[model samples]
Target: MTEATVAIALGTRPEIIKLSPVIRECERRDINYELIHTGQHYSDNLDQVFFDQLELPDPDHHLQVGSKSHGKQTGEMIAGIEDILLDVEPEVLLVQGDTNSVLAGAIAASKLDVALGHVEAGLRSFDREMPEETNRVLTDHVGDYLFAPTETSADYLRDEGIDDKRIHVTGNTVVDAVGRHRELAAEKSSVLDDLGVAVGEFALLTAHRAENVDERDRFAELLTGVARAASSLDLDVVYPIHPRAESRLNEFDLDVPDRIHLVEPQEYLDFLELERTARLIFTDSGGVQEEACILGVPCVTLRENTERPETVDVGANRLVGTDPQTIHDGALAMTNSTTDWENPFGDGTASEQIMATLRQTHSVRTIQ
Candidate 1:
């Protein structure tokens, strides 16, 4: 077997979406990279569909860690990933975003001889309350390479006393993914027609963060607020509900408002189509916020704060906490706002830049 020169670790839909560009760049350059999937957030809809829709190659190793307590899950991932690293003996390991898989990969690679690269590094919600904040902070400190997505993120790393030499602002791969796939989504996705929603007529919603959905009252308030806002604008909310949030609704016996249309989790192209065509988007996801901004759609973030504050600074998104009245007002405010805000994320070349940086720093085998 050919020894892999680089290893990329990821375990969630967002990671898959954000890293697809990098994977494609690797393929385009004929880099010998092994893909390791931790299976941290695996489901056919959430996992397989993304790989299928994005035309990504299958992972070389899958550690079926599944769901567990944070410590248990991450610990299992570390052991499994370390074993793979030992066998593959890659020079560098790459992880993206602030998932448990990322943290585990960082810890595993840090312990081994491999250099660790954290993509979308230095993002801080600053809310220690968020598990992701802890994951990102720890991963950034241990990583040998910090590929920050924006200057704001780079500054955050500098403030944290990290060496500026290790930080490189490589725009965001989401912009690359969106640019690469939006046209494909438009041509291939019939989601709007299947959902019976017209272009520029419906609102898209996605709230699945533990902070938002684990609590019955908070989840109810979030849903109610979005429903009220959509109803006031005479628009139907098409929610591609996350499994966790859907389970909460059932467990809480929460009543979904008539104006809210709940659908199963959608494939990548379909979700991108929904975001591209929606008049507005309400989300608790950081990726969706960035995607909305990149796609030139107005967004109202369901959370009180965001790591991607550039979206707010550029008038692309509003960070309104889950209050029915406040959400309604925020929706109204964004509806009246223009979608012409400049994309704070970089032009669609982040993938190319990331690959070039890797080649410059590491002695990876590349096809001539």
Candidate 2:
């Protein structure tokens, strides 16, 4: 039997972290796979640090798309990816999450002979305002393989008319990532000491989503609410601010509360360590919601809605939005809640399942 060739395309830190397990699986099995990185996240803290910490191979193709208007960035990625797909012509092309990079890869592969596989499929915030919502919806429809992370997500795909044959309920890779990296993070990360905070003593904050940070009023409210919550809880708020959020904060001339300790973005292991040890976490990031749930940390989502509603259903998270009083109340409630909520993601084998499914399907296609 001929070795199946797989191409994995990713951009952004979350994609890198979520997809690292699959990349390692390919190496372990000695599968022929190409790593195509769309440089959607250009910052060293956001991009290179994850690859270094994850010990992933340098990308075979780096499309330096960087930051542009959504259309411009996706258009550039489509061109670059289409060129690579033509050259490598892999049997399957894999893209993870709802970034513009994922949409571009799906669009490129759909026009080619290669089968498209979307990892972390069928997530929906149902808010058309989010570009990610559009990306995920379009990618799921175009994908030949929809790797839904949970039954709820699988149901979302079913309701959208995706065939059951194509929808595989593989657990979310974030669960696998947290399980695989938790011990490593504990051993290597000194974020607690570096930040002068102890385990279970500080609340972690990550609010970078445009919906939360792009608007001056919203950004101010989110910061004020989180800081107030932290103050009420008698805990320091450690915010690892994203570059975009930092720019917006300065642009808006918003006053960060004295209690909110703003720091530069962290590497994956360091951030994972923080998440695992935090007393409570507040974030607008979908991936953070998943990680906090898997890590058994109480989370208060700063968004109005979440794609990962499973986190809320499992009692692992609360959607508090940016209202100061609500955020304070929600934070108090979550901080007092039990951290024993079962992880809704999976039992840490998503990568293996995803890879096995690809191999079996590719082989069947070959034989037919």
Candidate 3:
């Protein structure tokens, strides 16, 4: 790589997990880079613990721009990130996933004329109602290098008129992270014993998306459906509640069934252990869907559609929105479903490919 320095910006637990492989490769190859935390998902449990569990180096910069209204949060992040870009003057600004952090990083880098590279690019739920959908679309348009996770995602980028030269078909980094961490999780996590749940005996649940959890009716319907599934199967459902979802639960005064156990958020390793061992997984999380597919677990997605259509196409996932009966039926079917499908994500070398592309292509168009 000709550039003497580069910067990778991210915030939120999913970003940390997905980006860990890239960070490690940079370190291994002795590449000059800095990690910046936008602090979009700031909290000890949500953010800090991921770095510790993943063994990633602490960030060189922390904007500390905690959560707020969408516009306020993104505006603050753009300002914070612009200041850092001015000081660091990196050759390239790399960001992962569709979050406020990714959008802020892309906007700041583009405005500063620092080449932008987006990982996990080209994914689209096509639902403009989703804030993340807007973030992904904007980031992809601004990014000079789009590291798409699959041919399907790459096709999405092409259809949007992105040139082939700028889009690279690198597999999703989540596969790389899981390959590196799953064995370690098996060795380290006691979540199963701690929660008194055995392998293949329980269902894993997570609902954090605003479309599902922030709306009282949708949230109530999701829980009711999940409860019905648990009752029918006589299987315990373990849910590691997100703080935002927990607040909504209290606000709505919704009752959780005894079969569904609500627990505090687990550390990354613990959650990985749970995801690997659970009989079936039900989630509204994009990352979780990818993880479940990679682990060969059948998944019931609590959304009308997914950006990850490959999972559904491969029979590893089923999308059954928040309809109570539909959700229950999907869970029942997935519980009896086969986990024999292939993982459409990559073979775990995505980070290396990303770094290699940046080095071999010298894709950075501007350095001032």
Task: Write candidate 3's Cα lDDT for 1-368 as tens digits.
Answer: 12336799998889999999999988877778879998888484568778988888889889888889999999999999888888878888999999999999999999986899999999999999999999999999989899999999999999999999999999999999999999999999999989999999999999988889989989999999988998898889999999899999999998887888999989999999999999999999999999999998889999999999999999999999999899899988988888899999999999999998998887433224
Across 1-368, the per-residue lDDT of candidate 1 in tens digits comes to: 44788899999999999999999999999998999999999494469778988999988899989988999999999999999999999988999999999999999999999999999998989999999999999999999989999999999999999999899899999999999999999999999889999999999999899889999898889989999999889999998888888888999999999999999889999999999999999999999999999998999999889999999999999999998889999999999998889898899898888889888987877866
Instruction: List the global CA lDDT of all models.
Output: 0.92, 0.91, 0.91
Off by over 4 Å in 1: none
Q: How many residue pairs clash in each candidate?
A: 0, 0, 0
Compute the lDDT for candidate 2.
Answer: 0.91
The estimated TM-scores of all candidates read 0.98, 0.97, 0.97
By the lDDT metric, which is better: model 1 or model 2?
1
Query: 1-368, model 2: which lDDT tens digit per residue?
Result: 22338889998889999999999988877788889999999584468778988999999989888999999999999999999999987889999999999999999999999999999999999999999999999999999999999999999999999899999999999888888899999999998999899999999999988888989998888888888888888999999988899999899998899889999888889999999999999999999999999988999999989999999999999999999989999999998899899988988999999989987877423222
Best by lDDT: 1
Clashes of 2: 0
